[model samples]
Structures are given as C-alpha cells and as structure tokens.
Target: MTAVTDQDHTDQAGDAGSENREGPVEEPVGGDADRGGKDGHTRVESAKGGPARAEAGPGRARAEAGPARGETVENAEGQADADSAGGWDDGLIARRVTAETEQAAAVEVRGPNAPPAAPLAYDAPLHSRLDALRELVGLSRARLDSRTLAEAGQVLDEAAARRRLSGQHTVVAIAGATGSGKSQLFNALAGVAISETGVRRPTTAAPIACSWSDGSASLIERLGIPPRLRRRPLQSAESEAQLRGLVLVDLPDHDSAAVQHREHVDRILALVDAVIWVVDPEKYADAMLHERYLRPMAGHAEVMFVVLNQIDRLPGEAAEQVLDDLRRLLDEDGIALGEYGESGATVLALSALTGDGIGELREALGQFVAERGAPARRIAADVDAAAWRLRPVYATGRRTGLSEEARDDFAARLADAVGATAAGEAAERAWLRNANRACGTPWLRLWRWYQDRREPPTGRLPLRAHPEEEATARQRVEQAVRTLADRASAGLPAPWAQAVREAAVRGSQGLPEALDELTARAGLPPGRPPRPGWWPAAVLAQASMTLLQIVGGLWLVGQIVGVMAPNLGVPVLLMVAGIIGGPLVEWSCRMAARGPARRYGVEAERRLREAASGCGRARVLDPVAAELLRYREVREQYSRVVGV
Candidate 1:
C-alpha cells in the first residue's frame, strides 16, 4: 500500500491583495502541474544563471544541476513544508469560517457588518394581540385586591361545574314564624327525630344541620360547625341516596321572643343556597316575612320553595286559596315563576304529622337537583349580573367626547354668568389708569399720546357705574352657573342627583364666606365718600365759570378763584396737613374692590371644579363602591354553590 502525502502551500508575497480580491485560493490538482506554463503560471531562473528548475521523476536525480538551483529547490521544499504545517494565514479565512459556522447553526446576526441574511420579525394577528392585552389587563384588575381575587377565583371554579349533575345538591331550610312547627317539618324531611321538637313557641334557638348520610361531614365543616354541634346520619339506604348532597337545615323561628334567634334565622337564610319557607296556613300571608325577606330576595327566584306546612288544619278549599294568594303576592314582589304547572318556585302542601305529600316533596327536591344540577348556574348568573352592574362604575369616556362648540358655548356662558368678561375689562381699565398714575412724567406723556391716538368713549365709562350695580351683574352670573349645574345633573340617578344638589348647596354657602375672607386679607385703600345732592348745582356753577375763563381770561379767573377758595382750601389744607392723602385714598378703594373681585372669581372657579368633581363622584366613584358590594354578594353565593 502507498502512503499519500497531504501537501499545502501558502504564498506570503502579493497574498494580501490577491486574498482581498479573489477570496481563498483553490489548490491545484496533481494532473495540472505540466500545463501550469500554458495556464499563465510564471517561472524564474536561479541566481547561478542555469536553466529553470525542472521536475524529475520519483527517486531520480537531475544531471547538470547547479549548486544554487539545488539549494533553491531545497529551500522551496522547506518553505512549502512550513506553509503546509500552518494551513491558511488569512484573517478573512477565520471570519468566513466563523460566519459559515454561525449560518449553519442558524444563529441570528444583527450588526451592519454581519452577513446579509433576512432578519426574523414576529407578526401576530390583531385579535390575538388584543386578546393578550385584555388578558394582561384582566390579570392586573384581578390582583388589585387579594380578597376580590380569591372571591373571583371561587366564582370561576363554580361556573366551570355549572352543567354537571352527579355532584348536584339542594339546600332546603325549615324557616317559619314562632310556633309554626318548623322543627317537626325538619324531622319529617329527615325521616328521623334529629331536631328537638318541644311545646315552647321557639324550641329551636340555634340552627341544626341534618344530612341523610355521613358524606356531608366536609360540608358541615365548611359551615363552621363542630362534630358535637352536628346531628348523626340516619340508617336508611333510600333516604341516604336521595339526600346524598342535600343539606337540610332546621332554623330557629324568625319571630321568636329572643332577638338572637331571629338574627340567627336571618343570617342562615342568607348563607343557604336554597330555602324551604315553611309557613302555616294562618300566617302564610304575614307582612313581616313577605316585605322584609321575600320582597328583598326577589333576585333569588331560582332557589326558593314555599311550603304550606300543617295543611291538615286548613279547610280543603281554603288551603288552595291561601296558596294562590301567596303566589300572587310573590309575583307582585318581582319573583317570576316559570308557569303555574312547572315553576322555579314550588308551593307544596304538606302535613308533618300525617306524612301527606312528604314523599312527593322529596321526589320533587331530588328531581330538581338532578335537572338543575345544583346552584352553580344560578350562582354564576348572579356573579354575571354583579359584573354587569359593576361595568358602568369603571367606565371612562374620552375627555373630548363633548363637542368643541358645546364646550366653548358653555365656557362663554359661564364666564358671562360669573362676571368674568366684565371683570376682565374692568381689570384692564383699572390697571391702565393705576399704571398711568404710577408712571413718571416721560411715561405719562407717552401714555397720553397713545390714548389720544385712540377714539374716546361715546358712552358712559364703566368706572362711573355704581358699586352695588356690579353686585347685580355678579348675581346674574352666579344664577347662570347654578342653572347650568342643575341642567347638567338632570339625567343622573336619584342618589347622584341628590349628591349633586348637596354639593351645589355646599359650594354656594361657602362662596360668599371665602370672598369676604379674601377681602378682609387684602391691603387696599378705602373707597370714595358719598356725594351730596347740592354737588350737582356746585359742579354746574364751577363748569360755567371754567368755560367763561377760556372766553374772558383774567376777569373770569379772579371770579372763579373767589367763589371756590374757602371750601376748596379747607379740604386741601386738611388733606395736605402732613398726610399722604392721594395714595391712601386710592389704596383703600383698590384694597376693598380688588380683593373681593379676585376672591369671587377664584371661588366661582373652585365651585365649578368642585361641582364637576362631585358629579364624577356620584356618577362614577359611588357607583363603583356599590358594584363592588354587589360583586361581593355574588362571590359569596358562588362560594356557597361550589362548597368553598
């Protein structure tokens, strides 16, 4: 066998440019050596000036070979051996190898200098993305409160089992007024003497839970009852099988002499998934139970059973009439039954002593459990209703939902009502006048020149209007605001409307006091004194003389001085007696007027803001609180259904 030599060659000179231009160079095959000259391969003679080195056959020596040529061949062979040992010397080879390995391995490259290949981009459907966002929002909402999340989880679990029938159960409660034989009825239902029946009006002071089988021990535990407090199961296979998941409760009389017994009855009724209202024929139409319990519980239409216990005492036709009247009363309370024949609310005639209709009642309860499959669906419906009720509470609308035109109109009307327009104009004129008075001679001259360039008022100036006159204007503005608020709250519910009204009253009552306080705090001057009626006659005489001065100068001036001197001198002397009178008067008036005006404006704005806030509280926050309560009730019902 022949051993094959693996030879590699690397050219150092001119290699950089060649590698840059042509990339990696391909090694020539063994058969192409003789045709290299024809294929443009270059050759050089040795320095000893002999013929170029020629290839010899294997194990053969070349004749007439110079020492330099021999040495050159040996040098070339040594270099070739060194190059073969090193493999490729180009940095590009390393980079290319790295790139190829990365590409083969399917790793992504992101840099601009990285290899040109399309990048991976994820594109999801709109609905799927929206669903993900909805799920995230739902999770965040669920985690807002630990109690709320726990309740919701319980409700969801119960809802998942809504359609199943095997694990279904009923919660028939023996409830009645005092001395109505509820305990005896409970004993009759259980087919055993579990409940203590006595001659007293309220024999059962506390509730007793009696199951047909011991399988309800866990359920009894969930009711927070100890083994000592619970009753033993009866020994009957048929009864046990029929009452597999049933939880028959014997409650204390609702109209007991002891208030605690009545409270216990009320509490247990709320917690139970279903109710068996055991009423005597005489007290079947009792107003206390009908109004307080039955009417309020109209929402629980699905899980209610009305039983006319002790039916043997009533006359044959009277019992039917009493049941009919009871049904009518329930219908008026918004408790809708499916029909007279097949209704959610079943009115049964039973005598605990005679055992009449006891088996039929048991069969009815069993059938109901088998068909309705437990209170899971009803509990889910309750939760769904609660969720729907809560939906409006957290509802938000776009701030710009109200039209721009409507908003602008409202703002304009509000400004007009609050005297904002008149106040702004008055402020501008007052500011200008005060500023002109405060300015030096140069600025005063410039102001006068500017004023002269503009047209003078053709009507009365606003400052000449009476102080009381502005109050009337302000009153008009306040009235408008009140009207607007009233109108805005018109469509709200009764409680919210009342809240808006209450808030408005509070705002109105507070506005004036706030304004007065602001006025008292301001450091401003007093207002002008009241003028006498004779001042008009005096002003007429002075004006007539002043006009004469312009017509007849010297003589008119002397006469005017003589008449005006005494009164004018007296006032001027009093004012100029080491008193800075002008500034004090101006300061007093500004202090009195500006403070109240600013406060009134601020208060009005505050009232409007408060009114808006109150509206939001009534229409949004309060509703949310109510909805949360409703949700809590639904959650409790769901927990009961799921046996949590």
Candidate 2:
C-alpha cells in the first residue's frame, strides 16, 4: 500500500476543481509495488519530487471526489496509517451525504470556490445508537404500548443481522407488482436470464439472487435464498468486472395473487440493502405501492430507486410525461427524489426490451455499486426512522425529578401516621400524673387512690394508636404515597409517568405497618422518666407537714378529754401553717415538673420522628428515586441516539 501524503489531498482537491461528484468509489486494491511508483507515496514520476506519486485524473478523480477527507485511519498505537485509510469508515453516512450533495450542485449555483463540504458524522456511533435503542426498549417494554415500539425493535434486529453479514457486497432487490416486468429488468441488469421470466401473472414465485463477485454467500443466506435458487451472473468477463461486488436479487411479484409470493416479496425487501421498484407506465401510480410501502419507507430515500420500466410501450414523450407524473406522486408520498444529482431517491425511465435508457440506468447502478455504501446508508436511515418514532417518549416538557420539599412532606406524613406527636403528648401527661401521685398531700393522695380503686387499672401509658387512629394513620400513609407519585411523575411521558407511579405504589405496600414497628422500636424511655432528687425532698416535706397536722389534731383531742392544761391555741396555729405549707409545696413541685416533662416529651417525639422518616425513605422515597434515576439514564441514552 502507498503512503498518502498532504500533497495527495491537494492533488485530489485540485482535480475536483469546481464540480461536485456522485457516489464515492473505493481505490482499487493492489500490492505495495503496484500502488507506489519509485517514490514511497507517489503514483506518477515527478521531475521535482524524489519519488513518483499518484495523480487524480478524470476517471480516477471520482474516487477522491468527496470533501477533502478530514477523518484518518489509526493504528494500534493511535498513529495515522495511510495504508489503512481506505478500509475503515469507508461506507459511512457522512461521506455518502457529502459526495451526493456535491454531485447535486453546479459550481455556478454553489459559488465557484465553495468551501470543502463540512464533515458530517453520526451524533453517536452506530453500535452505541443501537445499544441505546435496545436498552430503552427493554426498560420501557412493560410500561409502554407494545405496538409503538415494535418498529424500533424490528429495525434493531434487521440492522444487527445485516451488519453481521458481508460488508463488501451490496444487496439490491428488484421489487414490483405482478406483470410489471421486474424479472425482465433483473435479467437485463445481470446481463443474463438467471431469473425465470414469462407471461404468467406471477412468474417469479420465489426470490433468486445473482452475484457479480465472490464472498456473498452469507448475505444471500441471510435473505433466506436457498442454494438452488442462488445464481451467478455467468456473463462476459468484462460485464462481470464492471458490476463487481453487486448482489442483485429478483424478488417475487409484490402484487401477486398468491399470498406466499407477496409474503416473499415483502420479507426480502425488508432485508435487502436497497430496493429498485420496477413499475410500468400503467400501474406507476398504484395505491397499493404508494400507500403501503413507499409512504411508510420515505426516510430510506438514500437506498431507494424508482424505475419506470417498460417505457417502450409508450410513444415518444408519453414516457417522459409518465415519469414526471410518477415523480409528483413520489413527492406526495414524501420520498425525496434525487433531482439534479442530489443524494436522495434515484428515479429514472427504462425499457428492458427496447434497451433505451438501459445504459443510463447501468451507469447509475455502476456508481452505486462501486461505492459499496448502500448497506450502511440503509441501516443509518432505519436508525433515523426508529429514533423519530421514539421522539415523544424521550422529549420532556421539563425535568420530572423528585423534589426535596416532596420528600420532607412524605416523611412528615409518615410521622403523623405512626402517631409520633400524639405519643409525645401522652408521655408528657404520664409524667405529670406520676409526679402528682408521688408528691401530693398524704391524705389527698389516699383519697384519690381510694377513688381510682373502683375503676380498672390502665397498665401503661397509651403510646400506640387507638383503632380509629389506626385507620386515620393508614389513610395518611396512602395519601403521602399518592402525593409523592404525583409530584414525581409531573411533566413526564405517559409510559414513564405510569412507571414511576407503579414504582411508588409497589414500594408503599406494608409501609404503614413498617412505620408502626419502627415507632415501637424507637427506644423511648419506658415508664415515668428518671425521677429528679428534688422530688424525694418534696415528698419528705409533705410527710412532715402531715405529721404536724396529726400532732395538732391529737392535742385538740386531749384538750377535749380534759387530760391537759390550758393552751394558747398553738395546736390550731400549727394546723393552719401545716395546711397552707403542704398545699404550697405541692404547687411548687407541679411547677418544677413542667420543665422536665416537656424535655422528656420532646426527646420521645424526636426518636419517633427520626425512625419514621428513615422508614419512609427506605420503603417509598428510595424506590421512587431509583426509578427517576433510571429514567434519567435512559434519557441520556436517548439523547445520544438522537445525536442531541
């Protein structure tokens, strides 16, 4: 292989001059000695140069006619290798579009010195795009409508199968309705009658392939063609050499009366790299072809050719009129015609019997075959169509992620559902009741105990919910989940939104019970909070006051029985002081207990609320967040696929 240098690019550009070129043609493969002259990178002997270099001539100019190629081939060490330049990335879409667009315009129309065509590359590589589509489909399969994604899946499967086969051979299928002379045209293109053709309504019952070169067996087999049905060109050496690397398939009549024949046509058409629709003047505007296939496959203009075959039946300009009318119909069907050499659907007129316009068709096909880009172009178009179909699901009005406020609201709801606040209030009341029992006046305490003895004893403070509170708690939990789902799914597509909703619902099951369990295990202080030392002192003081009261009462009884001398009412004063002081001590203890009771209640509430929030996050918010994360990942993949 010869080393391509900067001069070679310049020479190629100079040769291109001011005219655009058609499809790119690959440089002929040869040994190093055959490629390089005396110089390492030169093809022709130069007087000023050290070695001979290749020059771009009229015939060889088309091979290098695209935009000055900016892309390079690299070796394992990441260095550019001119020897491998023609192998990798040859039949890619960017190159094809550049070549076709240049060929479509004139130098006069597109300025004389129009800058070299801008490099066009896939937004993402083909494999990456396909992988994105596969993952998107897998994730969305259960959530989305199956019918909507079926086309994308089919595109993925077909692309994989086609890419696995031979990249050297371009498979072109000749498809047409019955009695449309498609078989005749197929035989005409192959330069031999390899496919059977007759006056029968469906002459071609099965597809037959004719290859112009070797190494296409896998491709033929992929099309489901049996060995017996596959044939070679069997034409003159020159004819075979001209159409090298082309695998022409003659498909069954698409409009055949036989269901199997029509099925065969449709099946083969989908797998073929390019399709040549051979229509006669009579059925050129057939509704079946336009409605069913052409309109639906409008995006595949790069790999489509609409041939008005059998134009010999029409007189002089009638054929031209029909061709113009056909172009109009194709436009209406949304197929872009490759007018003025543009890179789009190629439409032409020809007759297999008369041989008129046959040379022009052959010339165009030769350019197409020489390029070996039809398969890549077809696959790229399929990807574009699939991506377009999937646009709605991926395109969002705004971000639909879970919000912080929403999470906080959910946690609060769960806390309420488990009755954390109510439990705290109960704790405060329990502390107050215990304090009153321990420090109240002795006689009063006795009287209260005797009064409560008649009623059943309540074992423990009521920390859990009553039956009615339990029902209310359940409702609160359900509402929290519902609100979270609504917030998370806002502005999302129907499928993704529904998936988020389902995720929230799935994680919410058993959540209320789980929160209740968490509250129970919240490690709250069990009975009355740890007693303060001052509580004991208060209790002793109350006992002393009670003693004083008893002493004063005994003395009064003695005086009444006349067992003692006259007193100055000391017993009465002592009784009055004891009575006032005891009530005052009890009131002081009650006031002091308020601070500790409030602190203890707050601690209990904190523990319960913390546990409830953590539970809610694990059971509900975490799952919802996971789902949202998945959506974000898939959205990024979708952007890569769409080249956003």
Model 1 lDDT on a 0 to 1 scale: 0.46
Per-prediction TM-score: 0.44, 0.66
Task: Look at candidate 1 and give me any clashing residue pairs.
Answer: 417-477, 524-587, 524-591, 525-587, 525-588, 525-589, 526-588, 526-589
lDDT top scorer = 2
Worst 10 residues of 2 by lDDT: 100-109
The sequence of per-residue lDDT tens digits that candidate 2 reaches over residues 369-458 is 888788878888888888888888877979789888988888888888887787787777667767877889987788878976995342
Question: For each candidate, C-alpha RMSD in Å?
Answer: 34.8, 15.3
Tens digit of lDDT per residue, candidate 1, span 1-644? 00011121223212211211211111111112221233322121112323223232332212121222111110001112324322332221111011111100000001122222221121233223223323323543522345434444444443333222223445557788876777778766765444556665567766777554323444444444433234433335676566666767788888888888788787666545678788887888889988988877676667777788888898768878877887888888878664657546777878887788788788877766555334543453345443434333222232212233533454455344333444445444444343333322333446766775695531122321465855764574356446544553454433334444455544454443343333223212233222334334433443343343333443334446784333444444443431343334334444544444455435434544344334333433344334334334433433333224
- Top candidate by TM-score: 2
